[model samples]
Target: MSKKQWPSWGHGEQAQQHYLVEPRALAGGGDVRHVHAFLRACGWRDKTQRGGPLALQSPDRTVRIEYQPAGMPGGWTIQGAAAPGRDAWWAHLGAQTPVEIVAGFTDALTQPRAAHAPNVWAPLREQRWRRPPETEHVTATSPDGSAWVQYRPSAGGGAMWWSGAQDRQGNGWVAQFTPSTPLHLVEAFTAALASPEPVMRPLGHVPHSARLRTTSVSVLPSQLGAWQQARITAARAATWASTAPRNARPRSTAARHHAPTGGARARH
Candidate 1:
C-alpha cells in the first residue's frame, strides 16, 4: 500500500495525489508473499515486521491492512510456548467489529507520491478510525469479553497476538502469536479470504459504497481455488473460526464467492 505518513504537520496538504486502492479481497490464506507482490506491483510497500508470519502494507492513504489468516490453531495465544513452557488460548467468535479499520502505522515511503502543496498528506486517508498509538502495537478487547487481543505487525510478517489481560497487567497483553493460535487463525482466514461483495452495514442496510461479496482476496478463485479445495479435504479436522474474523462465515462466502454456490439461490 502507498506510504501513509502521520497526518502531515503543515497546512494546505490538500495536494492531489494518486493512491492505489488494492482490492483487499484478493489477499488472504496466509498468502503474505502474494499480498506483498500485489501491493508492490501497485507501488505500495509491504511493511512486514521481523518475525511476523503475515504480510501487510499501505497501498495508499486510503487504507492499510494486516494480512492475517481466518483461523489460527490456538485461537489466540497469551504466552508463547517457547517462553518457558506456557500456553493459553482464548476463543473469540461472533463479535461485532466496525467496518472501517483503524490504521495506526505510517512511514517507509521509498516511493513517494507527489503531494500538491506544503500541506502534509498521509496515505490511507480513506478511513476515520482513530486513537493512534505511539508504539507499533495496539490492543483491542473482544466484544464477548472472553479475550483481550493485540493488533500489531508480525515478526516476519504473517499473524499477530497478545497475552491475556487476565494474565498480566500490561506486560503480556501484546506480542506476536505462536504455534498456539496459528492453526485457529489459519482456518478463520481460509474461510474469510474471499472476493469482494456487498455486506450488511451498521445502519441495518447495505451502504451504496459497500461490496456485498466476499472481501478477503485469499479466498478468491483467482488465487486459492486449490487451497480451498485442500481446506475442504481437511474440513473434518478443522475447527470453528477464531476471534478476529477475516471474512463472512462459510454460508456468507458461498453466497458471495461469485457464481451462486451455497446459501440462498438468488443469483447476484
Candidate 2:
C-alpha cells in the first residue's frame, strides 16, 4: 500500500501557532486517536462499550490497550500476556503526561521487531541528566530536579521495575513500566522525555498549579483545525488501506502497462 502522508504547514506559520509549554501542563488523551489508528493498522480490534473507556485488544487477544478520558491518575494503560494463566506485563501513563511522549511508547510497541539490549539511560544521559555513581539501581534526574527516571533490576516482589515522574509533588504526571515490559518501549519513552522539542497545550487547559511554572504561546484556531483534519485524513487512509480487498490494486498502478525503455536508471 502507498504510504499516507500527513499534512504540514509552513514552518513560519506553524511556529506562530504554537508556543512552548512545560511538560507538566500537558493534557492527557490527546494522542488516543493516533494510537487507535496505528493499532487498527496492526490488526488490533476495538472492544470498547458504550460509555466505557476506549479499549482495544490484539488480534491474538494477548495484548490490550485502554484509555480513560475521565481517569485522571491513570488515563492510559497497556497490558500484555504471553500465555493464559501467566502474569501480565503492564505499563501506565498518567493523565497529565504529554501525548507526544506517550506516542513514543505506543509507536515502539507496534514495531515488527524488538530492539536488542536497548540502553534506556543513555538517551537521558546524553541530554545532561545526572546519575550518581555506584547506585544499586539505575537512575537519572533532570537538570532542574523536577523529573526523574529509574529502573530496578531486583524488583521481583510485584514492584514496578521502570518508572518516571515529572513534578511529582505538583500537578505533573507519572509513568510506570512493569518488570516484564519490553526495554525497547522504555527506551523509546525515555528518548521522547529527553527530547528538546516543546509540546503544545491550550492556555486554558494548563493546570492552575502549573500556571506559574509553565509558559505557552497562543495557537491559532485555524492551525489547530488544520492539524485535526490532517490527523483524520491519515487515520481514514490507514483504515481504508488495511481493510481493502487483498487482490485489489490502485487504479493508477493498474492502468500502467508500459515497460521501462529509458537509459540506465538514476544511480542510488
Candidate 3:
C-alpha cells in the first residue's frame, strides 16, 4: 500500500495560520458545528477531552489545531495550529497563514478557484486515523526553586510527570505523573512533595518503576488551575522543607537528585 501524506505546516519555521468558515454561511445563515462535526467525522479527536474549545491533531501526527467558536466577538487566537503548506482550504471556503477563520466565512486568500473545486474533503476522509507521536517535553519549576518536575510526552497521546523527591522515611522517591497531566496538576504534586506531612502524598496516577522504587497518584486535568492559591499556601508554609536542610536545600539539578533517596533512571 502507498503511504499517505498530509499537508505540512507551511513554509515558515513557525506555524502558519488559517481560518475555517462555516460551509454554508456564504449563502445566508450558517453554523460552525457542521465544520466541527465534519472534522470529527474525518477522524480528529479532542486531545483535552474536556468540554471546552477544540484542540485537535491530525491522525498522521503532522498537525495540532485550536479552533474558535462562532460567538466569541473578537478574532480568535489559536496558539498551536500550524502546518506546512502555501495554503489550506475548504472547497467552499479557504484560508492561509495569519488568516482569520471565522465561523461562517472563508477569507479571500483561501477560497479555491472554481476549476479546482473537486471533492475537497476526500483527502481528509481517506486519511488513516492514528494517534499523534510523543514529541515534546514540558517542565515547570517550583516556586521556591528547590524542586522541579519534568513532564514527558507519552506515546499514548497524554503526558507523564517524572518527579524527584524524598519520603518522610528518607527514601528517595521517583514517581511518574498521571496521564495527560497539566501544569497546575504537576505543580500540586510538587507542592505536596514539600508539604510538612510526614508521609509524602502521591500526585497523579504515579506508577512504581520496578528498577527505581516509586509509587503513582491519580490526577485530573480538570483540576488544572485549581491549585493556584493552594500552591501559594504550601509555598508559604515551606512544604518542601522535609526534603533537605535549610542551607543544604536543593538549589540545582544535582541537588534535586541528591535530595531523592537514590539515583533514579528515567523511563522512555
Top-TM-score candidate index = 2
lDDT of 2 by residue, 1-268 (tens): 0111124434555433223444432333344565676567666799999988889997778788888866564578999886564467889887666677776787666554453688788788898989977777777877766667877665357656454554533656778888778678788888888765545545355444433243334444455555555544544555566568967746543332222111001111
TM-scores for the candidates: 0.21, 0.68, 0.20
In candidate 2 the C-alpha lDDT for residue 104 amounts to 76
| Predicted candidate 1 versus true structure: per-residue lDDT over 1-268, tens digit per residue | 2232223233533322211121222111122232233345444555557766343443333233443333443112122122234344222211011111110011112123334422111111112213245646664333223234445565675445432322122211122334344333322222221212222111222112221222221122322333333323332222233222556445343322333211112132
lDDT of 3 at 236: 29
lDDT of 3 by residue, 197-263 (tens): 2111223212222222232222222222223233333332343453347798756533221111001
Q: Each prediction's Cα lDDT score?
A: 0.28, 0.62, 0.30
Using TM-score, rank the candidates from best to worst. Answer: 2, 1, 3
Question: Clashes in each model (backbone N, CA, C under 3 Å)?
Answer: 62, 0, 21
lDDT assessment of candidate 2 = 0.62
Q: Which has the greatest lDDT?
A: 2
